[model samples]
Target chain A: MLPFVFEWQWDIGHGVFMGLFYLALTIVSLGVVAALAMTFYDLYSGKEVHEEGHGHEDPWADYSYAHDKADRGEYA
Target chain B: MDDSKFWPKGTTRCKPVHFGLWMLFCLALAGWALVSAFLCLYKGLNQTNMNDYFAFGVWIVVDLAIIALGAGAFFTGFMNYVLRREELKNIINAAVIIGFICYSGAIMMLGIDIGQPIRGWFGFWHANVHSMLTEVMFCITTYLIVLIVEFVPLILENRQINKVPDLHFFAHNLHTIMIVFAATGTFLSFFHQGSLGGMYGVLYARPFAARGGVLIWPWTFFLFILSAIAAGPSFTTSIVMITEIVTGKKLTTHKVKMLMAKVSGSLLLFYLVLKIADTLYWAFVQTPAMGLSPSVYYQAPYGTWLLIAELGIGGVLPCILLLSPQVRESYWILLLAMLLNCFGVTMNRFVMTIQSLAVPVLPFEKFYAYLPTWQEWGISAGVIAYGFIIFSLAYRYLPVFPQETKLNPTTD
Candidate 1:
């Protein structure tokens, strides 16, 4: 996606495509970095762990606990 | 075993034995792929029925089909993130997961489809700006990255996974500013979808596929984009319905399904009009310019009936069925219409790839037909197997459908 890549060209097609592609990548990366920075700062400052609530089931609990379909439906 | 922990907390699933059998079936298909890979790598593509004339073959067809079906991810992300359609939030994760499977599978298949898998990088290193394949390679790879970025947040959002403070925060931030990624994906997808068709259209040597149009892109270029998007949502809906039937659970509300159908039908209507115009122009002007009658294009093995089936049975009928409110509302009719729509696009890609090669351009050239050998079938099966394995994993792990909890509540 970089302009310096061997396939990179000065044409409008490559310029526009690669330009927007990099832009998106930058935004996504920035979002991640910003999140990391904030979390680290909070942790270092000993800000009370922002635990929302105990009842809030971890979103991925459903994933790690089950491999087959039958086991997944036990609670249902 | 706590079944609820695995099946989205509340959704019903088939019995363990049945699920095991299904997994076994998938594994068997995957084994077929292993054989296909061995034959293709050792014996070469000659193992395929494809000859010099039909170099593209079924691999290209499968590639195009998956890419077209995968458009739902970009289109749905566009709607949910850019257009601010909140209801679609329910199914956006599923679309992303499916998109991931389709793209990764297509890319993997392409790696093998080329004569030299290791040298596939030459397409980029020895750049051909004029080549439509170059454009496809660029856009598809870029879009795959975009899809992965889009999927990351969902992966992080998994119940047990997001417990990590860093991942949780990252996912939340990513979701907050997802519009940038979504818009970029839409841009990349649009071009690749068009370029795939552009690849065929620019083949002036192949009159059956060539066309005149605005700068750079031919009419087929635009038509391919329209057809992919028009059929994409329907394909996604069909998949969701299949999952529901298999699991005995509803993952999306009726309204969401109806909205998806309406969007697909309207786009299909627009596409049909343009496609028909393009066909007529090709028949009346383009074909004759190359000193061939329209009827000459379709003979014997590939007869007029193929066109009738493509445009009439596959095209108009599905469009009409989907567009009408009565038919769209009826689950059976809507499902059947979507199936027909998927069939129509596959047929279109098949014709564009195979039939284009089948039609002889030179008077001395004889018409040729091809059938995929077991080896070729194995590779194709491999791609399908890959898609199934990836998608099944995503569904099993990720909270792909937000509406799941509401639709089929886990009664603790």
Candidate 2:
């Protein structure tokens, strides 16, 4: 997916698509790096695990449970 | 007895032996597919029903069908992550796994579909930006990478596996910022899904497939994208329902399924309107410009009835069933509607890929029909077998359904 790949081009389609693609990749990588660094620092410092069971709440979590509610007639 | 003795711990499951037997049956199917794939490769595509006139054949149809069906992964990911549709979360993981299987399988089939598998890389190396097929190849491969990344955390979250400190941390961290990956996947999927239709549209020699459009993309490109996103959620619904039947567990709430149906229905309505308009334009403007009547394109066996099947039974019926709140809200009705929606999308892909090729575009050419040889079926069946095996494994190992333990708590 890199621009340097032989298939890569500098046309409008490539420019727009590859631009968005790379930006997303960069964000994800940065997030991973930040989390790893934080976890490593905590482990070495002998800090207790965060007491809050609040994991990174998934964006779709609540939506996911709605299926069961609908089945149970709770929504109606 | 311990809570763990309840089989899945959270819910009941079939006996291990029973599960193993089912796996064994799937393996047999896979074995048949392997043999078929070998025969097709060894004897060449000549072994299949494909001829010079219908070179694209059943393999392409199956490829396109699975790709379209697999669109659930990208679309659900998009809605859940980008659009902030929280209800989709329950199904997105399953969608991602299915997408991974479909894409990897399609890529494998392409390796076989090409005359020289090794030289297939030449398409990328030579870089034909003008060719829609090139765009499709690039986008699909890149998106497959994205799908794998999206699925990794899910695998890492497997009950026993998540205990490992490194994997656990990795999964947690990866998930914490999953929005980025989901965005990337959406972008990639949008292009590949369109480019697939663009591939057919660029066949200027085939008027039925060709159309006037902006830049290099034809109308089919946009139409294909609409149809995929429109029908994707329905496919996911169908799959989840099937899973429930097999597992005998209510893995999701009815509200979530209804939300999905409502979305799918609305999208399908939009898609249907555009599709009809496109068809009318093609019939009156495009086809006539090419010096052919609409009927001339469908000279029998693959005639207007095929159109009826796609547009009428598959398209109209499903849209009606899904759009009617009374119908879609009904459990059985919604299931039937979703089933029809899936069928409609598959038919759309089939028409675009196989039937388009089957119709001869040249003035001197005659219409042709093709059937997949046993070997061709083998490769396609192999894809199904692969999907079933992988999904079953993921379900068995991974805590894919976060609500499973909550909804079906053990009472020892």
Candidate 3:
């Protein structure tokens, strides 16, 4: 549905419909990527996590956020 | 309670033997459909009785019917995320699961309906940007992706599936951004539902289904969106109630069911008023303007009875019942009303698909009738069976109703 695609049209109908279409596709794809990255990072960082839904107790579970690579100076 | 090992925390399920028997029945249906599907594919559409007159047969009817029924997914999500109706959070997972089943099942059947599964992707590769059908194909395929995104977190949340930390974190992250997907779903759903109606409406030459509209969209377009939104929540509530009956457990609170019914009833009332107006205008104004009478539409095998059933029994009657506190207060009555409401919307689809084609625009042309071949029935029943199998599996493994544990502390 991209503009560069051969079938793309310059009219308002195609522009508006396809615009919203691609916008949604982009958002969902980005969300999936972010979730996958955070999951892998959390696993590698060895974050303390108690097993949930087993009716067990764990008050001292560790929670960590996936930090941005740029903020960690990866680009520098 | 031995299956408690697989059940969600603080909840109970039916005996596994009973569950297996239930699945075996559903699988038998699916197995029949699978054979029928292969016959359709290999032997071609000759396996069905469809012809030039009924190009869009039972399969399209099922497609429109289920997609409309499945609107509960987006509508419920819209309420929870966009409208922030926190109470809706309880039933949202079940809505998503049902939506997934309806849509994926529709797509699976549609693949065989086209009679060359290989060419199904042709719509995407060499798409027509201007065609309403192209819009429908793109939006439905995209929304199915969005539904998958919405449904995966639920699948991942299964007691066993979530044991993997990465999957757990992934599911949690997906939940955090669900608003994005929900809003996107609402956007895509609105168009595809409307476009499905638009497909019929654009047959301007066919006065039966065609109507005046705003801009490119016909009145049927808006009516479809309205009818779907009105019927969707009711369908979801009905499914939840049926599950409760079959399992002998209260999966959701009556309060939640009533809340959904109240919303459904209000929307249905709103839809009925407009639908009545649309029919009147189409019959009196539009049809007469085309030099045809409304009587031109009512033929043998399709009579004014269809319209009366769609509007009066299916629409107005259920609308009144669902709106009443007394009716909705009774669990059985509410379920019946929901069933009627669904019936009305499905009748609307059937009329649009079959009766529209049944009508003769030219006086020289004769009235027509269509009875789907066994192959068509086989495929259709298979779709229903697929929905049952998927939803059953989800209910057994996933925590579909968040309030299930709280509502039913113990089951005999």
Candidate 4:
């Protein structure tokens, strides 16, 4: 067991372990929340989202293509 | 009879009949697993070879091994999103899918291994904050959720699925903020991997498994983390290579594989150095301090050969081959090295879980050799079958390999 830390005290072990664990959970939950918020906003605002391989280009297409090119060693 | 519409754009798939046959094979294995699970649940723990002495058998070993192998998802995500290693984007999707398969499969195996499916939540409900297992349970389940969240974007990106405007915007938004999940995953994965090793390390009664350490964490804790990150990318790359061979298509560019190899080799090299030191210390100092010779821990069946194979052949040899620029360029050689690297980590897990328990602590107690029953083997095979089915489905329908179109250009 955590012999170095008292059970009641918020010692370094509990502080660091539980703190980081909760911090990670918060970040993940917040990310999902933000995505949901954005999705609803875009849907209600009547923004047109480009479907994959559709005539309209994907917003992330340029960045992804550049990454693909780089991975293929096409660019120095 | 065209399912091609559902396939990723510019990709070719086998005929439905051929894919169906493959699915049938995987389903057979799944059927076997179901029977085994039913027997184990109905007949109780007596259906398996596990006993009071060997509470952990093949299931635990496979669980540990796959979880370690699955480290690629988080590590790759961390690199691509957090470190801005954009080239990794080509392979990151595959890594995520593999991670999902591994984590979810592991949790399922644990559900059976725990012997009581109903009260399984007790571990979470009545939390033991002091135990390393609590940390592992919390992090693994939480990280699995993160992986699912990460995987959702890809699932939403499927050709047919992407057409829904709301889902499209949701996937896009998720992609934009993926760094947050990636960072969170990295944090969870790091701790769980370490806590698993720490669980073994903290077995103070089992001198074979116990180790001296800094603060609450043992050397095995850090070693587990290092080995997972090291072997993880290699396992992911190996799966990608196998998929390419099976499908007869180029999925990702060779450079992406090379980057993975480089990352794996560097981390592996770091891991090996410490692992060797840990072994040496355990053999010479730690074992003697416990009033037991290291040789006592390595009796017949768990002989010195296990150490030689784990460290020498599986560890050092793979490290050398992977780090060699000339050797890595050759496809088969690189694949062999990565497979060997994975074998090394799996062997390490086997040794930690099985061998540690096999050794007799008390003078009257005898060394117990454990062979898992058919039910155990079936369950293990089912995990592999599950992985194959999941990966196959993901690769077929999802836009898993971003570079797939460019790598194997179709001539119409």
Candidate 5:
């Protein structure tokens, strides 16, 4: 239950339940937001987003570089 | 008119006419679902056999089952991205599409099942935070959003769509950060899957479904999670195998399918051990404490055979078959084992939803039987049809199976 709702309470049950619920929501939302931010940066910076090279390249390589590149602002 | 350009590179699809016919058939089923949905919405819940005694019916059984089956997407993502089980990368896209279809379809069915579809958000608005259903509501809806986020990048990767500069960048960015979404999804899925079983387990009045548990969670909660992760990979693999059989092409390597089967079998074996222990305790200890014999729970139409089918034929048999090295190497045998694993989990949900309700709780109450009407069947058929159409389109157009081009190189 949202804290703003009339039925909402400040008890432990609502606290723990909605706490985890919102935490998950926040994480997912932030993930999407981060992607959007990265996308906008890539678009405006004249970076070329190539079609992923297929046929036996390490499939997990993209994910591996995401965070490291994000930290360095070099996602392109 | 040739759509070969749209096909994933190095892959071949059936002729357009043949694909069109398949789409038409799927659409017909969707039409029936639409009609069924319209009637249920216009005529109200009375269109089906559900009554006060049967508050949940076939729809809930299906909702729970597919959600369990769809766990493949999140679990597979978790394994691939988080655990770094790279072989799953070959099948992960297909898994995501299946998860999207399953969750979206189940939500639609729930919309119809609720009868008053407009008030569906009331579950969130006027929340009962203590209820397991409330948790299920929050987690399922939120996880569906995560699934959409996961699926969109794949859609953007469509051959023609990938040509767009901005869209290409967006999809690439999404893939770059997929681990975050995958972790979030795994968290959401774990709770919701458990809460589903916890909903039935907390029905203390219904001895058939109720169970003892660890602090703040029932045994069924853990069991449900275990069963889902066990069967989810198998269901995903089963779909891939079916796709191969229909297309006469190898979409993925044998190693990928075998890996999925092995994961499924190991998890299934763990689940069965706990499930059998839980069943034994429920029968000998928990049921008797409620002053009801386990025998009372298994009457005509809801007989002991359901237990055998669920646990024995579907459970242990599949576990053995899947875990066997020789069987895993044999394509058909592996698929059969996976199907049985999926069936076992579905049956677990069925009994939990339907049979649990069928068994009367009160001393004077009678054991009641429920049969869903044609409309109910129509709605269910519609969900299946929806899945078929979505999967067919994704397979035809998207690079769903990474190993596809490699496994089935075009000679020409």
Candidate 6:
């Protein structure tokens, strides 16, 4: 997607397609960079270290554990 | 139980031994593909059934099929993130993973199919600006990157992986700006999906597939987009359904599946109407103007019955089945309709790639039959294996279905 690529055309078709291709690549690259920047910044700043809401805080809280108990002949 | 730590929070997974056995089976198929890929790269294209007349074989067919089916990622993203549909968020993660697998695997197959992996970059560095294939190469690769970016957060959300503070935060950050990547994916995918059709449509000399165009794009271009948009969600829903069936869990509610069905049915109706119109124009006006009858393209294996199956049975039936409230509410019937819709789109692509090439463009060039070699079959099997293995891992590790926890709640 570089300009130095020799097969590059100076026409509308090439301009439009190549333009869009580079644009997408740029957005993807920037998104990754932004994520890294924010992540590290969060680490440096000591932001609240919270776990994901789904099964993060207490794995044993899962309903499947109840199934395990029932399977073992213990009534729910 | 050994792998419970890896499972998404609140979720229960299959026994490690069972999961390991499934992985082993996938590995064997993958091994066949690797051997096929090695032979194709080392020996040459001759290892396959491709000939001069039948230049595009099962590889292209498989590639086109997966890429079209993969359109669910962008379309779903467009709906959830762009159109602001909250309910779709429940299923969008799975859609993204499927899209990533389909696109990336198709890229790998293309690398093998082109005979030389190293030279595949020439499509980018030395692009033919006017060629539809060139457009497809550029858009598909870029969209693959977007899919990866969209998928990164889900990876970081793995139960153990999310324990890392920085990685967790990074995943959170990515989610915040996901709409940008989703929009980019939608843009890139729209072109590649259409260009794939334009690749067949631009065969000005090939009367069966060629059509009049506006500026540079052809009728098949728009039709391909509609067909893809129609089939993509249905394919995703079918996969999710299969996953639910196998896992014996309600990954997402019937509401979400029904919503997807309604969307698919509407698009399928639009596609069928346009496709029927396109076929009529091609059969009566376009072919006659080129001094040929529709009979020229219909031979033994590639005959009118294929058209009947593609449109009447696969296309029309599914559209009706999905649209009816009664049929769609029944889980099995709805899933069957979605499956048929996907089959219809696959048939369309197969006809475009295989049947289009089957018809002789020149008077002296006779019609020829082509079947994929065992190596070609092996390569295709590899794509399937790759998709299965990756999705299996993702479903095991990541929080793919948000609704799973609520639907199948465990007693505390």
Top of the candidates by DockQ: 2
DockQ value of candidate 4: 0.26
> Against the correct fold, how does model 2 do in TM-score?
0.89
lDDT (tens digit, per residue) of candidate 6 on B1-412: 4878888888888899999999999999999999999999999999998988888999999999999999999999999889988778878988999999999999999999888788888778877787899889989989988998888889988988888888788888888888889898998999889999988888887777888878889988999999999999999999999998899887776777888999999999999999999999999998988888999899987889999989988899999999998887788899999999999988898998888889998879877678899999999999999999999999998999887776667674
lDDT of 3 by residue, B16-112 (tens): 8998999999999988898899899889999898887788899989989999999999999999889988777778888998888888888988898
What DockQ, on C-alphas, does every prediction get?
Answer: 0.14, 0.27, 0.13, 0.26, 0.24, 0.26
**What tens-digit string does per-residue lDDT give for candidate 2 at B1-412?**
1322322334566667777898998899899888877777777777777777777876788888888888899999999888988767777887888889889988888877885687887865665655677767767887887788788888866555655666666677677777877887888788889988888777888877888889767888998998888888898888887887788777765667788888898999999999999999999988988788888768667888888888888889999999897886577788999888888888888888777887777668788777777788888888889888998877776666655555554575
Q: DockQ for model 3? A: 0.13
Worst lDDT run of 10 residues, candidate 4 chain A, spans: A54-63
Q: Ranking under lDDT, best-scoring first?
A: 5, 4, 6, 3, 1, 2
Q: What value does the lDDT take at residue B82 in candidate 3? A: 96
Q: Which ten residues in a row have the lowest lDDT in candidate 4 chain B?
A: B120-129
Error of 4 at B110 (Å): 0.2
DockQ head-to-head 4 vs 5, winner: 4
Taken over the whole model, the C-alpha lDDT of each candidate is 0.78, 0.77, 0.84, 0.88, 0.89, 0.87
Docking class of 5: acceptable
lDDT of 4 at B121: 80
**Backbone-clash count (model 6):** 1
Q: Measured by TM-score, how close is model 5 to the native structure?
A: 0.95
Clash count for candidate 4 is 0
TM-score of each: 0.89, 0.89, 0.92, 0.93, 0.95, 0.94
Better of 2 and 5 by DockQ: 2
C-alpha RMSD over true interface residues, model 1: 8.8
Error of 6 at B97 (Å): 0.6
Q: What is the interface RMSD of each candidate, in Å?
A: 8.8, 5.2, 13.0, 6.4, 9.7, 6.7
> Which sections of candidate 5 miss by over 4 Å?
A53-76
Please name the candidate that would achieve the greatest lDDT relative to the true structure. 5
Give the least accurate 10-residue stretch of model 1 chain A, judged by summed lDDT: A60-69
